[model samples]
Target: MSLGSSKELAENKIILLYMIDKVNMPVSNHHITKLVLENKFMNYFILQQFLNELCDSGFLELSENGGKSFYSITPNGKKTLEYFVNLIPFGIKSIIDNTIPEIRSDIKKESLISADYTPKSENEYIVSCKLKEDNFTLIDLCITVGTKSDARTICENWKNNPQQIYSEIIASLTRKRDKTNRDKDKDED
Candidate 1:
């Protein structure tokens, strides 16, 4: 599984970039391994080598969490990814674009994709996606809603009442369910 040459690395770079962009998320080495295994025609060692080369080139960044390495796109890597994505044939891109999202959504619904949001304080919550290593955390916060005044109020209220934030999400879901039930009844009538 020696990458041994630049041409091999370049080929791998193309495939890896395509896979990453297609998924639209940071991917772990395990995920890449699985993809390579499924393809059968691809050389796993070559893929690994390409990944290393990309990291060296600053096109990708690797974070170790737990014991595994997770690879994320850097700004330069994103530019390279876009270049490869555009090279995809239109028909092939159409099929992949249509199918990949459905697959990713199903995986997320199954909780295969790690996601968690924790309330830190009123008007603030810690939102993170689990990476491969415990120390490597992708954390962000969301505040405000709507536009102009409505957005300002949402942010102000959220800051004042943290617990209410969670409750609001629940309330929204409940309202949606009740509305759906009423619609079903009306349809039946």
Candidate 2:
């Protein structure tokens, strides 16, 4: 590649790192693809390559979350970003600064409640639901269904009402136990 393309590549790499670094979340490949395309930063192919290259080179870390590839900046990536962030265009930096908050909110929402399905066989599917707050995981549930549609519906329900579901489960589990403990404590008092 020519000098211009090379520089653009480095800048684009930094853009990916900067975005991931800014959000400080396990950003999905889809989100990265969308951001790069929407910002006119680069093409999808280059974005994909950058993700792989960055992770491979220890500039980023990759993990599977919610059955999708999630990328986060490694410590090395942060240092690199800190060092060469000036090379990224001010327009690009401005756009990233403006866009990251929305991404942060979206990722936070995603982390709060999540669902995914895996096929067990020809007819059975298992849907896993997760409800989390900050660093604490409130619930992690798996339901098995005979059909894919059933699994999908369960996932939707879990995503829609994880908080309520968690509350109900907690209430049910505590109801009898709490009542018994309260009766014993009243007698003692």
Candidate 3:
């Protein structure tokens, strides 16, 4: 559908807010930028301008966490967007609805567990891992290893069983603490 410059920008902003509102979790900037690109919402320059305006106007909540930008619709944004969502073309709305599930699953998987590696020297690397929920990372760990293969192994293992590794670590530490306390008590007695 065709729209005037003013109407186009407004509808695009509404579309953004609508996407944020409909999604159960915050939408990352990458995801939003991709959407804008795939659907030809506007040029990157205009998209950025609208994004900033929305944030400055309190229509969008922009947060940075885990080195990523995530956007959510503020209450005012939702309230304002409610009035304008219908203004978006039905085709766009349908596309948004169709696209959300894939986006949601991808975000969910990535946010739950993540791993990365950086080379510190010719033979050493640092592997970073994170376990996250709702913008909060329950676990963030970095380990230095001897080789890229070692780092890759750790990253892969962490991504596969982060929760299990976390639980085991906590449990082992607690058990050791409890045993130490018991030994101290016995010696005193």
lDDT of 1 by residue, 7-126 (tens): 545555766666666776656777667665665525777677778888899988898764557777788987876666655446544655565575565434323224344465565554
Worst 10 residues of 1 by lDDT: 130-139
User: What is the lDDT of every predicted structure here?
Assistant: 0.59, 0.87, 0.85
* Candidate 3 TM-score, true structure as reference: 0.70
**Weakest lDDT window of 10 consecutive positions for candidate 3:** 1-10
Relative to the true structure, candidate 1 reaches a TM of: 0.45
Best prediction by TM-score: 2
| Each prediction's RMSD to truth | 14.8, 7.1, 7.2
Off by over 4 Å in 1: 1-9, 84-99, 102-189
Determine the backbone clash count of candidate 3: 0
In candidate 2, the residue pairs with backbone N, CA or C atoms under 3 Å apart (3 or more residues apart, or in different chains) clash, namely none
TM-score against native, each model: 0.45, 0.72, 0.70
Compute the lDDT of residue 2 as modeled in candidate 3: 40
What TM-score does structure 2 among the candidates reach? Answer: 0.72
Q: Evaluate model 3: give its lDDT.
A: 0.85
